[model samples]
Target chain A: SQQGEEDPQALSIQEGENATMNCSYKTSINNLQWYRQNSGRGLVHLILIRSNEREKHSGRLRVTLDTSKKSSSLLITASRAADTASYFCATDRRNTGGFKTIFGAGTRLFVKA
Target chain B: DVKVTQSSRYLVKRTGEKVFLECVQDMDHENMFWYRQDPGLGLRLIYFSYDVKMKEKGDIPEGYSVSREKKERFSLILESASTNQTSMYLCASSFQTGVSTEAFFGQGTRLTVV
Candidate 1:
């Protein structure tokens, strides 16, 4: 079963706009991470925010986590055509004796030029 | 830099044929994973290996099996390929650094079954 579910299955915005993507999960997690995929290729890790931290920033990317609500959001400050891709949120949780990471279906963002 | 390499970037096979997908990570990570990505289904875990000669089933493990004879290599095998099994296969590895350490992925293999 999938642990995280991303909101706004798809989003479209003009260049230079800010894009926000939300993810909600069902269970507790040690951390939440976001990734980007171009077309159908492999994933690129963006940011990882631990449960102890509520917010983190890397360059123009800002991520916020609300463990109480089991939700997280990713904010792209300045969008560009190059930013167009599929974004996914993943939750890392303890399972059995090890850890398992579950990824959300993802949000397709299109930054029009 | 850690590198996870998949044997093939694209593959084609006939239905009912045996298929093998190989992955190797040079970072000496303890955990390795195999995931299949589809159009709307996102990435689904097929199998995971925490150590050499150990493996575990993921959510969708019906048509796939895995082998981890060495710590740096993980192989995903399809006993008999089917049309539905064709998808983008990704390999990843992560160290047991702490809570929620990052995972690095390979270039991915796109398999097409006809």
Candidate 2:
């Protein structure tokens, strides 16, 4: 079973607009990570936030984790046409041996130019 | 930079034929994983290894078997390839055993079983 489920299965916006995607998980996690994938390509690591941290940022990307709610959100500011891709949230729960990151269904974002 | 490389970008196999998908990481990371991605199912874990000669079953491991004879390499095997087994296979590598470990991925291999 998937440990996380991403919201807004799909989203579309014009370039320069902000894109926000949310993910909810079922179990307690030690940290959460966000990833981006271009069409038919490998996934690129975007950012990771520990359970103790509330927010993290990298370039135009911002991520927030709310352990109380077992949820997290990723925001991409000033979206570009090149930013079109699928975003996924992976959970690394405590007690898992190693590299046991469970991924969500993912949110497909389309940035129109 | 960490690099995870897959043996092929695409593959084609016949039903009932044994198939092998190979992955190698340059960083000597102790952890490696194999996942299959489908349309709505997202990415489902098939198998993973924490060290040389070690393997563990993931969420969906019924049709897959894995080998890790070398620390830098992991191999996923399909005992008998079936059409339903065709999908995008992904390989990843990570450094440690904690939640904060970041995984590096390969470009993926699209397999087609006929």
TM-scores of the candidates in the order shown:
0.97, 0.97
lDDT of 1 by residue, B3-106 (tens): 99999999999999999999999999998999999888888888888889888888999989999999999999999999999899999999876566788999
Per-residue lDDT tens digits for candidate 2, residues A40-110, read 99899999998899999999999999999999999999999999999999997443456587899899999
Assess each model's interface with DockQ, reporting 2 decimals per model. 0.68, 0.74
List candidate 2 stretches off by more than 4 Å: A94-96
DockQ of candidate 2 is 0.74
Off by over 4 Å in 1: none
- Cα lDDT of model 2 by residue, B7-111, tens digit: 999999999999999999999898899999999888998887888998878989998899998999999999999999999999999987555478899999999
Measured with C-alpha atoms, the lDDT of residue B96 in candidate 1 is 73
